[model samples]
Target chain A: MTDLVKESSTQILAREMALTEQSVERRRRIVGLEPDDLARIAGIREVVLAQVDHFASVFFDYLSGIEEGRVLTNNRALTERARELKRSHLIAMVGGDYGRAYAEQRLELAVLYGRVGLELRVFIAAFHRLLRSIGEAVMKSTPQAPLEAFASFMALKKIAFFDIGVIVDAVVFERERVIRQQQDAIRELSTPVLQVRARLLLLPIIGVIDTHRARLITDSLLKAIRANRAKVVVMDVTGVATIDSKVANHLMQTVTAAKLMGASVIVTGLSAEVAQSLVALGIDLTTLNTIGDLQGGMDEAERALGYRVVSMDPRRDGAPLSPG
Target chain B: MPVPVLKQGSVLIASIQAALSDRDLVELRDDLADRVGRHRSRGVVIDVTALDVLDSFATRTIRSIAYTAKLRGAETVVVGIQPEVAFAMVQLGLSLDGIETALDLEEGMALLQAREAERVG
Candidate 1:
């Protein structure tokens, strides 16, 4: 009964066109529906309206009876709600008004459906059920008007095909966006400069130093130094597995820039491989203080500031000494 | 103008105040070498805290002064090298070859005395 009322041409056209125009101005300019396509689809409003409930009930009943949908005991209320949602979505689709809001809504649905772990095979099968049910519904309604009914049914299929293609694209786009966000977060975590002591910073490089990572290191380390008002920066590169001339040059520049900010730079953890590489490139690391490890660098920085640590009772701390 | 090389006891303090051109640095280098000889200085301290820039030419001049002072039996220490200047040298790969450095004037004076004692002992 509701489906028959929803099939009223004037009411359906008025609501769908209003929605389409409200957001048509600022929409993702995708493939569009021609006026002819809209007119052809609109001609079937009466047929779709008369059979909407039957088609929806057939699609939902089959979905709920299937093994995938019956995975859990879907309570009665939940099944009814899900059926209603599917019916409304089908009604909107047959309305034949697609725009950005339509695309965006599909994007949200894609994310939701992905989270539910809906298998593509199951979804494809469900869509086949939709086609058969709607086709059967329209055919039964217009048996005498065979030619008109076939054209209207084909128009419905065409519109549904376009929506499915958009859905697939939106799902892929959303998945890629998630991956890019994860990469960005990992990149941020990978490069970190810690202020280990007041006026002292420790940067421990833990992986390969590609050009992109190198640039990130420079910008972040420089910003950290200035922000901390640090007097010393001890860069520990023990974990850097392989380095080339380019990485070496970037490290050199970072050290230099840190110094320019009035902070003394001490580089630590120079592996034998890196040392040899530096020598081969004719790059000089002698001017900047290069220590064996983080501890040595820390000790050197503390001593430069005229402070030293000694175990109490067992050993004496820095004793006051006479200056020459 | 030529940079002045002032004498403080047995240590000669050459405070580089003005922006040094290539020519000025060369003249200062000669003048420093001459003054150390005349004063019979035991140590030379080149204070470069006021310098805004330290190009290759300036760094080379300072290194040469340190070498010349060494030959004249005076231990040389380049002191008060601002971090910015040091950074520039490192980027340029100057290395300030063979020049001893101290953090400040007091450290420079202390280093000079220590070297003197090492020699005497």
Candidate 2:
């Protein structure tokens, strides 16, 4: 079933999910940054690196003290458990190359933060606390020129905010990617097209026919029809829970597209609910060929294929000597 | 340029080999109808695989041409619509609804033959 139209299913999946996988190069291009500013931020790497542990301790101490942060951490010892990870994130913001490479790493961090139940307010407050710690640490560590340290801290601030923006976008993109992948899997499972006979295909739709799955069903069925030169396609909807006017329209379009390719469609498993909805919506699916169940649809397909089943001796189970 | 329509036995085969101007499509429509009448063709297969874009004008022409051929007793089957074009067409609601279609020329001819057999038998 899968091997028949392998390439097309993947092609459609990629196209539908393409909008979710945001490109780091594209993001970098949009948010242009000068090398000097990056260098200044990079300079904080060593300074932060020395006091990173202290910075993490201070930040998490402040976070775990807050009511929202306590709820986020579930009252766990966040300072003891997550300090190392937080320290590394701070170091990455200060030292790591703010390019495509770090953007990917930032995505991982985003996913982790999202899973850990970090809310936006808490997240912003945590960043603010880190900035305060950096100011205090810089004042204590720097000598001679406080103004130069201030400039470096300002650069660090810009980089921090920029990294935060990237991380937020990455979180949204990752969530979307995961959702699209799940949709792909569900679509694949629900709209399984089987080669029932020599030139006959069967698609049993067993769930909600959202527009995504509907498009996938159409693409897959058409591809199978073209590849196998199928004479008939049976779309069984016994498993479909329910559908709206839009989904009904999708079915019409699917039938039309398959017919356009010279394949006769037999949509089976039309429960009373779907029929009622079609009637209520006034969606004219009269042009589409349909049957009651899988067996009936297959029988009709066999008839269309000019196959006549008759009881015969097991010795030759159905081979005629000649066409005549 | 006017699209060429060729007679292949009882079936007529024509492929839109280039992007047709409005005049060309109109000419093709009239020419196909005339040939369907003259040859007493049983089937007409219009292939659009080579066409990059199938605009509303072209879609309407094809639909009207199919109707005209059907009026002259020739069943029309459009063939070789690219997958993307089919998807876009369905979305645009220019479904060309009720017209017979095939994946390629071979299937188109087979469908025509099957219908012819059904009609006779």
Candidate 3:
């Protein structure tokens, strides 16, 4: 379900994020990567290809040694799948085509790792150990020329950093998306419009009211008023921590809209601090029909709706019943 | 299409059927004003229940219709201004301030009757 909603594959995800060829070029420039670096990465392709299996085993060994990493590598099927993916990723690092395709591949892997609950820190630690082993193998292979091997290692390091940068971005992007979805859920949950009587509604607003939430509140309240044919609305804002001028203005607009729909809105339970701030902010309060508390607001709404609360017991009237 | 104005004794009730263009709105306003004068309606109720959007132009035209009818000795009560339409109007800073409003056709008639009673008594 998440995969469908979040864009299942790298192609769609890349397009959505605008990770085009031009953007990839821009990122390479930002990382100070040169044509020589690409050539060097490709040059070490054969050597790394031969040792990729060794690097994968070393990577798995490092992961199995760590407590947090064991949780991921314990499953035999998952370990075999991850080992194959890791081998391809190492080979791709030296494959030299560092464009949108390369970035998408790396992004796909990052997302996969993320789904399996691999923390970026753990992935980084294990990957770093593998890279070190590869660097040592390269230096040992080119024993005659220390400078050549060091150059290759440094070039590879730059690309590794670039890869890590993209992975970190992917992680942050996923987290932010989750936060936005959660915020939407909270916004929907926060403002509840309840029908109190035949022709009355009570909307208790609680939490921080951003512009989006304020708009939502107005939309839903209006719909509720229509649905219930509510003649009066008592909006209680005591649970709201603060009211800025913008929210105050939105409340006024909501009141005006309700009035236009033939419903009177009685704003109730404005905290002392919020009321004081509104006064201090010089917001126009004269148009707002504000009451001290929910009880008073309901009473006022009942009165406007012509709902007389009479005690069913005749004795409660404090007068003797007249006999025929 | 022309808005049909049904005369309910001393009151004129124009139930808007669908979204109206600017031209349609002007026609409705003029039609209501002419009918109110001819019928000598003591009250007029414009039911906007069907309107999904009440923009500034529509709001202004409705207000003008009410004022014109009022000058002809007819009190106008706008009825069934759908909640969404009303919210949109306020967001646009438009208001039907001088005219009275009622929840639906029934309430509009009740309000008109009460006013008539108050005037006679």
**Cα lDDT computed for each candidate against the true fold:** 0.70, 0.75, 0.84
Scored against the true structure, residue A101 in model 2 reaches a CA lDDT of: 48
Q: What fraction of native interface contacts is shared by candidate 2?
A: 0.54
Give every candidate's TM-score on chain A: 0.53, 0.51, 0.73
Predicted candidate 2 versus true structure: per-residue lDDT over A210-296, tens digit per residue: 788888989988888878878788888788777677877888888877776678889888888878887898877777787777788
Against the true structure, whose DockQ is highest? 3
Quote the lDDT for A141 in model 1: 77
Error of 1 at B85 (Å): 7.2
lDDT of 3 by residue, B1-118 (tens): 7788899999999999988899999999989889888988999999998888888888899999999998999999999987677877887889898789988999889889989998
| Candidate 3 wrong stretches, greater than 4 Å | A1-23, A137-151, A172-195, A203-229, A235-254, A267-287, A290-296, A308-324, B1-88, B97-99, B104-121
Candidate 1 Cα outliers beyond 4 Å, as residue runs = A1-50, A54-85, A114-125, A128-202, A205-234, A237-250, A258-324, B1-121
Instruction: Give candidate 2 regions above 4 Å deviation.
Output: A1-190, A280-284, A311-324, B118-121
Residue A284 in model 1: shift from native, Å? 13
Q: How much does candidate 2 score in TM-score?
A: 0.55
Please give the range of 10 consecutive residues that has the lowest summed lDDT in model 3 chain B.
Answer: B82-91
The candidate 2 chain A region of ten consecutive residues with least summed lDDT is A12-21
